[model samples]
Target: MILKTILSGKHYQFKSVKDVMAKANEEKSGDTLAGIAAHNMQERVAAKVVLSQLTLNDVYEHPAVDYDHDEVTRMIIDDLDPLVFRQIKGWTFEQLREWLLATTTTNDIIHYLSQGLTSEMIAGVCKLMTNLDLITAAKKIINEKTANTTIGRPGTFSSRLQPNHPTDNLRGIMASTMEGLSMGIGDAVIGLNPVNDTVSGVTAILNTFNEFVTRWQVPTQTCVLAHVTTQMQAIEDGAPAGLIFQSIAGSQKANTAFGIDQHLIAQANQLGKQALQNKGQNVMYFETGQGSELSSDANFGADQVTMEARCYGFARHFDPFIVNTVVGFIGPEYLYDAKQVTRAGLEDHFMGKLSGLAMGCDVCYTNHMKADQNDIENLALLLANAGCTYIMGVPQADDVMLNYQSTGFQETATIRELLNLHPIPEFETWMEKIGISQNGRLTSKAGDASIFMEKESM
Candidate 1:
């Protein structure tokens, strides 16, 4: 029998998990692809099978699957981890919902799910929950997990200096870096999205960052955001590769457009790891967004949210130092307005955290988008409360090189102060030691300005 589901206004048909696996393999064959494909397929299959067996009364009255008591118990005992099974083996859906809501950390939830808590079980519990309950549960999970977890290096809140210039001029790059540093930013990593993707161009950018870091003795690392191949070449050419950067999308066509396939991505991860053995820093930086698959005309009928999740699964393979969802930068075709953009930001953060990624949100929009600073402000606050890892620190929320608006250094400060969040531990310590910041507040000293200006003159 064929089961049909509507996603992203498109109809998808599946005979079984086998059919889905076959299609996934035909498109892109890999362990990560197969794993995500199986999980999605099983979730859909379980939803149909479990929901069909339940009656309205059984759903509302007992808040449990409408199967025979013995059979349901047997399934739970057989599938779930012994600890989790003991907790919910004989419990109704109401009980399960209570337990899940009481669960604070995503790590524990992930462990349970990994131990075989099926998606059907989750769906059943969700059916009995109110929106408030779901939201509350989500908040608890994000807050607990993100508060304790550290990525790249240990820190509470981290941010990056994305100083890009269209012309790839050293002066322009130095100006942006100095501006960000003056504002006490760049804790996560100082990275540049190069206008030039070739080996020579990328090498120059990396060498420039290395020189700056060495001259000023900055605590943070730097990255020249180019294709993996170009980055590898720069490393071979004696340039510092502080981080390996790439843009990733969900579908094969989209990945190819970014000059990546699963094989290349794996190879890049391996290369980054090998290089970082001597440097002793986290090796990979990845950027992703919703609507990219559709933007590339390769979504393959999945909704933007699901496609984004699949990209996370793809990114997780590398255990990246940072995975940023460029939420509103994709434009209005997919996410039309502020509400959609805000929701996507929160959803991406939640999804990334659940998947064990060090997630950051680029609270940003474009000139053509139906969004503004207010939209970015609201989303940034929400992400902060959600325990987001980092944000993009551009100048005045405007990326001159990329032609997009994002959270600037001042905005990051506003959120940090509002939430009492600090930068990553090492960089924060450096900031304090250098007198650039004191008591978690930026000094914006006159001497620093003179220093940068003096360097610029030379």
Candidate 2:
């Protein structure tokens, strides 16, 4: 509906609601690669004009993927609150954006509003928002969830201490973990991207992290990022897991490509809830990224932004402890450069928060992307200001195992100081007790991994 707009004596037309959504999206290489992007900037603006006038009912009527054919679409549609949808179905996208930014609209209001929204509605409103609008609105919402420790509390920034070793060496992994913990990182999680995805290998790493955590009384979670099935098996075998990790996409087909389905993920959710020792109300950790659907041939003619928004829609169903978008890890073919990557990072964080999920970001880039560490660092700072739940803390901003650059332990510590933010309250207490940090600032003992060695030889 309302897919035609005339701007500057030029006629622009979109074939469908999905077409309008794709063209209205900001410039991203991924949408272009999918052959769905606007041909020119003028057309892009015209598409936004058309999108602004479209009603919520119009978008809701046209799910990006057919409801019957796709379980993701079905879930998004079926789960919508009929009462809330009726209250706002007549509202235009422009109105939605304005209401979201209105001073009278509080965080609780948006959380209530989210129940009625489908992924298309979220992506449509996002297209009409500026970067500052995303930041301003997202800052109003803080979705805190607990998994042993709470995240997303205002004035507290968190990081996942990713001590990944290429060979899954327990010694090297623990060394990186100790260094990160020493600098007051790992409050969010001390997670690893294991080179070995085997159940036994993952279990061993989980045990190692448990031992270290138990020894030091770290008030954080430990996760081993592996396949959901692998993690489920490990959990079933009594492995020490704080959070169950999985990479999810926006579409059923893409998730199938990842060897996952809603049923399987639901099973893992149930398993983690029952098996893990510190299983909090939220026991799942999900990672998503733009272009993943396209890469797997599962976008179904929707734009990457819409697909990415759908990811949050799916993740929220599980009450995840944290759901992060690996923004730039897909490479230049998708995000292209720092600007696009930054935009995507902000958008994903905003969308996740709007969906009522505790959102984090792996503010990261690969070597081939037209981005560097500085660009990622800037994005991380912006995200932190947006009240992002957490970010990854790899060693020196480089992931030797994942082959990407992310925020480092130093960056997490520095951001906390710059923003006058502290880690989780329980974690900060532990940090102070061990002399790694003092009164929200890093102590002289910070950054020394050998401090952990004072107890026993590893």
Candidate 3:
């Protein structure tokens, strides 16, 4: 009972704290919402969190004054440890790159052979980790750029129109670099196009699979993606033909391919069996960050980072995404994203990562407005990491195809008809390898996933 109450209290307190922070961010009061951290949790955690990637400029900690001080400094430092450590703006990708550059740059290679730290001493390598130089370099770049352009978003890597947008490109390079780190198994990714709330954007992408295989002169593989249990049954009740799967909320097992949101499933089961009674094959896809609204006005769909970080667990129950909106194009009207012509969302930032994972999807697929070149790069990393072997993006007339060949996992399909017009050389290279006919298709052979089940046997 104590534990439950503690958890409940934490949730309640956290919500209240977040609300205060949000208010401060909009600049409605004398205290910035981030400063509201001072009100919610420990001073240290509050300090660090408020100054995260989303609000880097908003934090005003004077290290020289605070750290060099006496008792007060120690008190402040002690509290901020946990919160500041969770970096919001520059995240895992940049941090990992900084670590690599620090330890093994071209200049450092010679030193390694001579007297640099060795694996034996590496046990406590955190002691050697320092990014003062990296920080300087990043700052130097920031300084060189014009003053008006936006850099990164307060909450994500999404860039604003600041003239100092050098950080915008860094996100792509870092994303591509980090692609090598992925273990490449048990992926749960989503593909979304600007919905304008029309489910057809999603349906169109789904229908493309058949055309792809037919053009390739291979048999088509079908899959079902649904959220509601009854929706699953209703679609299946008609006894649909093809690969049908359900994407539930809470229960997710990659091999099982039937886990879904516990809450939604309960709603369906409680509503009666007849709620949806279709029988074919379907998988449930649930959103981790979404609350009651499956569709948001932001039109910017899911959380890409949260998806990649927990892909294994999510696929065990649900694919990471579904049909939704993208940011950037967010406005009152559900008009298409003019910037990303083909579809609406999917690219760098957290959203891009999910799209990247979608490139490797079997049970999930993606569609978005026409994306920019940079967005393409970010999403590509996710696809490559997911072991996608083929692509469906491009036009039937194009001489080349875009393909992401996963060594042993799943394959991805792209939307070729929309992609062919946008000329990206790398994108083209992918096309040539994959062979894009509006109807081309591919799949990933399931690598051994029995290891995840070892605990069950025990």
Candidate 4:
């Protein structure tokens, strides 16, 4: 895999709110960074850790150990640092050299690489080692971004901790996710009345415009889905006439408790469809695996679990009249029949973590990844290299966008006001295929849904 994922510009690509705003027309929502950072936090972390371990074990290594960061931080990274050998908790330059010489590891004293080192710490280290200029440059970039940044609040996306999430990336994206969702949190309930029922027959479907996310024990951001497949329809159909709305609403509420955020609505409009299709290449994929572990949807129960196992994509390309469900309702067991499937040997506890590049969040990390998160990073690198865009089943991924409430999809805003979000260029046509209206604000007849979802395969 490539060492880093570079855009056409080669440097890490980032666009502020203003950048996208400048390009948008009256009908267009100028911001859509979701296309860029759409990958899950866990997947990214998994990729990062895997890459770091691969690099440290093979490509590069510090000649000595160092103790400069927090006490826990120092211990966690001591074996790999190169400048300070023994003394920690603030050591002078003289103390640094003497300790390095005393250590048996190496006298060559090459590079010092550590995790969670703030730009300030890097600057101090830079002052001591003139040869390590590259580190200084990287640190400078970090310093500029965090110059006056505030921290994430409790129950916020950024505040939730990943054992080894890159601090810089986490801080930046969490803020964005938290803010976006905070702005407009609304779900449309699409219920239809059928001609035959004594009571008004209806089914509720949920939909939302922001990049949908969910948690899978650990904070991971991968591919999450708002799907309505044969299985979902059966549930909706089986329920009482008017009760379908309550059922859908209850399902969503339940999902929220399990770290899943689902919205009920008609399909996207014309432009919105294309955007979702373009960005969500693996729209229907989820984290699959054998046995109930940390990744088990069993924690969510049968009704929800069935939703993940049986639901297909909402688009007509898969099935028509489909409504998207929340994230938690799906889990890992749907992915594998064998108990052997796992990520980093964590026993597939994170059953939701697996599959797809840009379109997944719940890939199974199992017992193995938990044992060594570097394994997770390596995974991230592979997915990043593959050009895949998302991951859904990890906890951090969902929390990164939701709990923080920094910036995300809000129901009240128009296409322009919502930052980094846009309706698909041809969303309405896609909705029409299901007999739904253009804006997703109107509902179609129940018989129409039965006709639209006539196909069972995705």
Name the candidate that leads on TM-score: 2
Estimate, for each residue in 260-323, the C-alpha lDDT of model 2 and write its tens digit. 9999989989988888777367899999999999999999999999999999888988998999
TM-scores for all candidates: the values are 0.73, 0.98, 0.29, 0.21
lDDT of 4 at 358: 13
Better of 2 and 3 by TM-score: 2
Give the number of colliding residue pairs in candidate 3: 96
Show how many residue pairs clash in every candidate, following the order shown: 0, 0, 96, 116
Pairing residues by index, what is the TM-score of model 4?
Answer: 0.21
Candidate 3 lDDT by residue in tens digits, 69-148: 32222322343324433442223222423443444333223222212211111111111122233222221111010011
Please provide, for model 1 over 94-196, each residue's C-alpha lDDT reduced to its tens digit, 9 standing for 90 to 100. Answer: 5556665675545456545434333234334443444345445445443221111234332366778888887989888888888887777787788888888
| lDDT score for candidate 4 against the true structure | 0.23
TM accuracy, model 2: 0.98
In model 4, which runs have C-alpha deviations exceeding 4 angstroms?
1-287, 290-361, 364-372, 393-458
Q: Pick the candidate with the highest lDDT.
A: 2
Clashes, model 2? 0
Candidate 2: give the clashing pairs.
none
